[model samples]
Target: MTAGTGLIPVHKTDNINKLKSLFPALVHYGNSDMLPMHMPGHKRRADFMGGIGKYDITEIDGFDDLHHPGGILKEAMAAAADLYESDVTYFLVNGSTCGILAAIAAVTKPREKILIVRNCHKAVINAVTLRELDPVYVYPKKCGSLGVTGSVDPEEIRQALAKEKDIRAVVMTSPTYEGVASDIAAIAVLAHNRGIPLIVDAAHGAHFRFGADFPAAALDCGADLVVESLHKTLPSLTQTALLHVKSTLVDDGEVAHQLQIFQSSSPSYLLLASITQCLALMAQDGAKMMATYSENLCSLRQALDRLATVTLLRQETGFFDYDPGKIVFGVEGYGGRDIAALLQSDFHVETEMAAPRYLLAMTSVCDTKETLLRFQTALSRLCHGLPPRKAVSFPNMETVAAEKVMTPAAVRERTWAKRDFRESSHCVAAENLYLYPPGTPLVVAGERISPEIITAIQAYVEMGFMVHGVNDRQLFVVSENMSG
Candidate 1:
């Protein structure tokens, strides 16, 4: 294959066939309600003499624009909303990160108070900062045996809403990074009764509504706004996501304005086409595909359950419900990072997420029985080859009182700079420092650092885990010197 001015040559038809076979969702193209005379000048033309593929067209005439969609793009979004059973839906060219930012920006004002679960993604923290919103932290339940963060109690959200009467909205992560889900219905009811809207970060729950084993979607539970990352659990390309608006809590104009502000002007036509394709596929055979995926996931979990060294985390105890596709296993003797590394190096299987005690595997409709069997074989081998498990010392929850010191707005005003952990003990942090994979922050901006946080930071570094927003080899500490 050669690349030139928007033209390329295909040398082999087998390569194209193999690619299509790998992703059956993209193999066929059909004409339906979408008119090809608009922005995409290709008119569904397959023969692009240049290097570009057939779908690589730009906004031109009859094809409605993405930013201001009132034509074909709008119709596609409406169809997607109907499939998801939401009031309105918008295609997100950027990842869920952009949708998150836009949703937060749309509902709250500068420096306004909002309630957020502490175990949120880093994107939430960035949204809080960008919108200058204050966040009242709600600590999620902790799993002792797995050393993993679980879902937040609805009572905790109720308490925060009661205490902070001025809270404009509540932001939550359902089917969390660990695949743990909260009682979104209860939370939504509480927020609505208090005249506030609930915005759910459903980035990992794009297929929840289509699957039998998955928990009910955030929108189904009365959340005002929900963001879904289609690429995470669905058969869409990377950076393709959806932002949904349900009822009247938020104005449509405000939501549209915020989306326009956050979204890219030069959106990729390839990504948009992929979204359309994935949506159509889902509408056609999503339920059947998800049912098969669920069976595979359950079988894999059952097989893993038989292993003595590996303990699978169940959703009934700490979590209200769970997404079956997310396979989280707890190895008794090995750190999650070590187990993940071992799986990658020895078995050539890469896990989705890893923490101190838990390793996560995300199964999609694309996953095959062979893939699951391979993973099982590798995990059993690893269990037999590993040494005795060590007892990890986690900080006691009683000693760590949940503190609401600075609001999200206050945290945003502060500047962030990297400082030596050894030298900057008493200094305040201007950023949320966390270990990746799980993406839970031990320390937030403007809060006094506890010895517990310092110890966690050191432990994470020694374990060779990637810590975000910090660069020190030994330790990552926040500095008072913010001039730089």
Candidate 2:
């Protein structure tokens, strides 16, 4: 009767009370067909846990270990670090990319240099090429003519820690993923006035500190590692993540030994019981469900600001805050994947990323208002008779040339090939390309691919946008590397 007891005895102030769920072992093997020899080749069936493989589990005996969580997964990560205030919290079943590779390998070491924040998140450049560190970029400030990407200029992180020298940490990407919010309490006082340590990917801000209409949660604006992604906007489950540790200038036992060396020594007690039932439903009803999801996202941004060919991109996108559950529409003459494929073919509505001039969506508390009034009656019946589009400005994708020439540990000791980079150039790049709903790279594998990074991968392959590190249009570079 133990594996997290509760067969129904809730309300310790219910919002999923008394934090149970430490592997309900697929809810005690659901209607017990009891057929498991185990070692998950998904024998829990229901066709691969679609019905939740009878609580998809493993670490048996009273279900403890998530790399040392004691009982009830350290009381559901200390009630999700007291509902995200954080001094510690770490669950992350490999989502915020193994908590940004264990918060950039528990704060820099290898070649130590840090400071990133230019459109970040390709798991912070694969945690600066697996902690070989030395990055230094910080840019992001676009938002005008809304080609998005904003925030991060705490005096360019106090002039890159006063002209970079022995700098050790810093990384940004707050509400971004189209919600943009930086100035985490003035870049955590310019990296604790140079004792460095910022680390904030805040994975699309796991519902930004519950809410004051979003933007504050980077461990209450003084980051020292963050990484969220509770299924990107809560209601968890789907690579549920957390990883917090708010400062002590990051050393929570080397972020639990770099989350036991980048998580998954088999840890997904059903994604840690969906991140402890999304922090007990964000501590029993997250602020009246984030103030009724910011009053149905400010009445769906005043009905998408009276349509007239749509434009919404709110909170004056220069960011210091902006996450009205990340809306971002902008459609004049359409092309955010043709208005997300005309609302996924006449209103199945799906959206949450599209850019080449907007589309994003999001909203939470598991959204409803009759599916946002059937998406405001199919976006005002697909902007009625169309043809208005005159606003153009949303394409900048910052930071392209910070001059590397080498050291991503000498571009992974070269040797590569590939070619046809649209009639090549000063080649050197061997890969790190870009464009997968902002994977943000544009040449970063020992860089030098110039011709303005082959015209930004030929304008994201002539805007049909695909570009993820060469294959057709080839371009891998580094063949016996002569010299750029």
TM-score of each: 0.85, 0.35
Candidate 1: stretches off by over 4 Å: 1-54, 387-418, 473-484
In order, candidate lDDTs are 0.74, 0.74
| Displacement of the residue 358 alpha carbon in candidate 2, Å | 6.5
Superposition TM-score, candidate 1 onto the true structure: 0.85
Clashing pairs in 2: 15-284, 25-55, 26-54, 26-55, 147-394
Residue range 1-484, candidate 1, lDDT tens digits: 0011111112323312222111222223222334556444555555655525444555545546898888667777877777776778889998988999999889899989889888888888888888777788888877635655667899998888888889998999987877778888999999999988899999998888777667888888889999999999899999999999997898867888998888888777678877887877766677778777778877888889899988787665676777767788878867677889999999898999877767888888888888888988999998888888575654343224335456545655556555676555666666667777556566676666666666666776776776775675433333455442
Which candidate has the highest TM-score of all?
Answer: 1
TM-score, structure 2 vs. true? 0.35
Q: Estimate, for each residue in 330-356, the C-alpha lDDT of model 2 and write its tens digit.
A: 777676888888788887889877877
Per-residue lDDT of 36 in model 1 = 51
